[model samples]
Target chain A: MQFIVEDVVTHLAVKVTEPRIDAAIATPFKDKLREIVVKSRKPIHLDMASVDFMDSSGLGAMIAVRKSLPQNLGMVLCALTPNVERVFRLTRMDSVFDIRPLTAQKEHRE
Target chain B: MTPIERSEPKRSTRASAQVQPMFHRVLSAQPETVRDTLQDVRRRFQGEVSDDTLGRLELVLAEVMNNVAEHAPAGAGAPDDSVRLPVIHLCIVRHTNGLACALTDDGVSLPDECILPRSLPALVMDDLPEGGFGWFLIQDLTQALCYYRESQRNYLAFSIPFAQSGAA
Candidate 1:
């Protein structure tokens, strides 16, 4: 249950390094996300590029985390692998959450 | 104007055994073991089926096995501290049409409903659904998904077509 957090201009991007997020780490993952969500009022971006698989519990955990946040703050998912994306699509969660492609931002030309 | 004689599309005529030998393995009903078992199952069928089929199989297996580990008790009315770990038996076979999987667990049986939901519930912000999506995903991706309780054991079987076609 390791995540590498990156600071973006308007949000914090957390990259889940685990290949799979199933029942084993669902609860702990939710707790960790809660801690981060509460600490920062800015929007959060979950980078799931490395997560090739996510079962029901993992999907549930994500939903729980999103619900725990204050209404003002926001959470978005990005860079989901094809397999993981299917779960979201099949469950109709792609419409519920703000999902972005891997190329969410372009390099700053400063 | 000329009419072209069209040849019929060839259908798969390979025997089940020639495609892939039936895979069977028993594992302790634990989250870690279930995850490992799914990985092994995926590896075994990687080259045999399309990636989409493999992904569906992996998702279904994970949901079922994890449900067992999380909710199924070792014995009926057994004390939590004294309860023993249960075992799950998994079998997979490749048919011409698709892949079939059967899983058996000696843990507690499903609720009286004994059936999966027909569709996923709406994900509303006021009342979020943390769980209950497992069975929906399984039912959406599989064919002939059935469950039976007999002799104090839970048996589940389902099939995933090699092609991308599905009810959901």
Candidate 2:
């Protein structure tokens, strides 16, 4: 459940430091993400490059966090590994979130 | 009920005549123990299978085992090594096209029969669901899945192909 938050140009970017996001860490992951999301009016960007695996619980936690956000505030997910990306695709979550490729050096949301 | 054997694959010439299938059994209601067993199983299949296959295996096992850990009541004297631990038995057998896995747990049965959704609900942004994705995810990841209850045990059997494929 380790993450680092950075204030990007207009959005707040949170990079998850964990290699695996599953049932074991989903609750804490949600809590930490919610804390950050609640304080920021800017949109949120989640950098998931270090996450190699994510299970249903982790996916649910992400959804929960997204739901807790204000309607005008947006959320984006970036750099999902193939393993983690597969879960997003399997659950059709790819369509719900703004997913970006690993090589996207910079993303700006207006 | 008897297990189903669908399209058993011929043994590869490189495989030994006596290479046994992989199996792991543990008696614990703790989720961490179940997670550890999954890591052990992944190591057991490390080079023999594709990463996609292993990921699917891990996903399905985690979902089911977590369900067991969260819901199953501690049975009386089922654990010899650790008293009051629930038992989970997993067996994986290689098939011609993929792998067949079965998970057995001494836990409570599904409330109104084993009814798992075959597909996920539509993802509407405003009214999205936070939970109820476990069984749907399981169904989407596996080639086939079956659930049954007998003799006070819950059995879930599924198949995983060595391809990067799943239902959305």
- The candidate maximizing DockQ is 1
Compared with the true structure, the alpha-carbon lDDT of candidate 2 equals 0.79
Instruction: Check candidate 2 and list the clashing pairs.
Output: B9-B96
Candidate 1 chain B minimal-lDDT segment of 10 residues: B72-81
lDDT by residue (tens digit), candidate 2, B114-165 = 3545568667877888777888877777777888889978888888887745
Instruction: State what share of the real interface contacts each candidate retains.
Output: 0.88, 0.73
Q: Given candidate 2, what's the lDDT at residue B122? A: 69
Off by over 4 Å in 2: A103-110, B1-21, B74-85, B111-117, B164-168
Residue B44, candidate 2: alpha-carbon lDDT: 87
For lDDT, the strongest prediction is 1
Tens-place lDDT digits, model 1, residues B1-168: 565546545447764226465679999788988988888888888888888889988998898888889875546235564776678999999987888899999888877443646667766768978877887887777888888989979998988878866344
| Alpha-carbon runs more than 4 Å astray in model 1 | A105-110, B1-19, B74-81, B112-117, B166-168
Q: Please write out the lDDT profile of model 1 over residues A15-104, one tens digit for every residue.
A: 888898899889998898788777776788988989999999999989988888877777888888878999889888887788887663
Worst 10 residues of 1 chain A by lDDT: A101-110
Per-residue C-alpha lDDT of model 2 across residues A1-110, encoded as one tens digit per residue: 56799997888998999888888788998999898898888998999999987888889999999988977888889888877888888788888888986436665433
